[model samples]
Target: MTAFKPALILESVDEIPESAYIWHWKTEHHFPFHKHNKGQLTYVEGGAAFLYTRDKTYFLPARHYMWVPPGVEHYFQHRYPANYVRTIYFFTDEDDTSDPFYTRTGIYPVNNLLLEMILYTSKWDGNVLPGTKGYRFVKAIKNILPDISEQPLPITLPTTENTRLKPVLKFIQENLAESLTLESVGQEFNYSERTLIRLFRSTMDISFFQYLKLARMIRAMGYLLETDKTISEIAWDTGYNSVSAFSNTFYKLVGKRPSDFQ
Candidate 1:
């Protein structure tokens, strides 16, 4: 097989033929914020990816896919090297406007049936024009998505641009394994605990502990997808002393145990 070239795809996606398009590639590069004129569905394999919007970040784990509606401003980040990504872009039908699914952006886990269907299209790529068998097959994939992908993964993190809070959030992310509390963080940043609490509430609409928990979970997710660490090691790295506590909290937030997630 030929090596994947991201520059070629990035330059040609806009000028492709009518109806639909498919591009499969292995990439470690991140895309800058951009939008498409048509709806897009991207399936991920081998490694994980993160989608960033203006105010939120969405996680797309392995064996999962993300739907980006037409004209939604966003970008994709690959934390690990050489992630396999299969993407298909389609023109929206007039009837699809009535359905809420085609209008919203989300990330969903892919079942075996959907996985097989997507991989079967590896024989073809780029500009699946109307009246061809490839176009019909891909259109069917688009039609069945709403029924199979009703629930999106709930691993989104709220983002902020406030100058005062950006450094605090960065500190929490860099020191997930360290003991973090409002008082400790305030001392590091030279603010009172009460003032820090109010800052979190006003700027991010979330508590300090709440944000810390979420940041830890997100880090744990990256470890689960991209590393060979044991559950106990991952728990320790994510600031948990006991495996049970980490497993329980992981399940509660991510709907799966660390072992199952791997």
Candidate 2:
């Protein structure tokens, strides 16, 4: 049998200087499905990228990172032009008894300190080992990471090959300001209500209705967090007929008021 070869591999843990490392992305590139023995925090200092695993595909824009647990098979694509991609990997062998969040994987918000530390550590060529530092940098990181905060953007990303939901997702994205329904989509796509429901459940692991709501919610989130748009404006822009309806739906799905993300 042929051995499984990874597209990228770091030397063994003992050979490395720290618990994490970084690399830059030059031009657009795609890394085929692969697995890492250690958990990874994938962040980019510039541009954006997307990650696809067995269960879901994640869009990681700038100022964000996607966490990947150890031994999970996944693939990634870097954006076009030269981009600065920074990845920090934690050795799977590190037994952190208190780190509860290490096992969960998703896209998350990045604070200034976390961003700075990632950038700072990426500069370290490991001149000094763990204990020789003024303060144990790697040790500090292990503790700091768990509390960085997790902002779930629960959006339905399109699949690579089987994209029954692609046009539906695209419609939702482009027409976020308008009302929608699976029945309406079925009519447009020439699919029956029964087929649409089945395909959506199979393709996205969610109902067509749920995915539509999530798609709206994701766009609403971006406007809420990234812009100065009024909640009422965002409400209408995100397909809600009323601000109250939008707020309720946003709160229900996001577990926070739309204003909170601002």
Candidate 3:
């Protein structure tokens, strides 16, 4: 089936209510590549959201949020249905000292304090004008972001446009459930293992194994949030034969067990 396209409002021209605004919705769909005049904060309350930029795909799992700076061209991909996506948009002053956090894009796990603050905005929609209670509350959330969102989730996969690597990456994504390895994949694509490794490093700046692990984790997160599948089922679906092995690797990378993450 073809992907559903959501109507996008370009903040650059849209008549917004104030410097601080909010828009949110829940759907198991995606937004085509788009951008805005003000920086955006996207919080995924259910399921997961994948934010795709020019050369990277970031995984925003459940209970996590992502910050996209102003004018950054990107798109959203939701793998499962009924995913709640909450967004807050705000512009910073030119001389604002905390502008650094508003300049970079990153995925951050939500803490209890921040989570409560974000959920409080659920009663609010549209431009939260200055000098209002809602406006001050949301602005305070933005200001504390730099301090709270210090460590970014490194669940991003570099994308590629190289003719040779593109098809190879696509093949890997399509066959994640299979027993895929560098040697087997190289044979399938008619390359020596060494040559395939070199291609990955040169084009993506990531080793072959590192890329595979991240790709598997991304898929696993989708299954965990989107399905009622057992942990063992999800593990095998992501190419791990042993549940313990899968859980260990997941904890090492995601800092949470599969059960906990779910």
- Ranked candidates (lDDT, high to low): 1, 3, 2
User: Would you list the C-alpha lDDT of every candidate in the order shown?
Assistant: 0.84, 0.66, 0.82
**What is the lDDT, from 0 to 100, of the residue 233 in candidate 2?**
91
Model 3 is weakest, by summed lDDT over 10 consecutive residues, at: 1-10
Write candidate 2's Cα lDDT for 1-262 as tens digits.
1122223344432246344543433345466677666677777665556678876667665677888877788877754232566666665445534465777677887889888777766555422344545226645665677777555555545452467767766666687787787677789889899998888777767877677677677677666655668999988888888899888988887678878755
lDDT of 2 at 252: 88
Score every model by TM-score.
0.89, 0.69, 0.86
- lDDT string for model 1 (190-226, tens) is 9899999999899879889888888888889889988
User: Worst ten-residue run, lDDT, model 2?
Assistant: 1-10
Clashing pairs in 2: none
**Whose lDDT is greatest here?**
1
- C-alpha positional error of residue 179 in candidate 1 after TM-score superposition, expressed in Å: 1.1
Off by over 4 Å in 3: 1-8, 11-18, 94-99
- Count backbone overlaps in model 1: 0
Better of 2 and 3 by TM-score: 3
Error of 2 at 67 (Å): 1.6
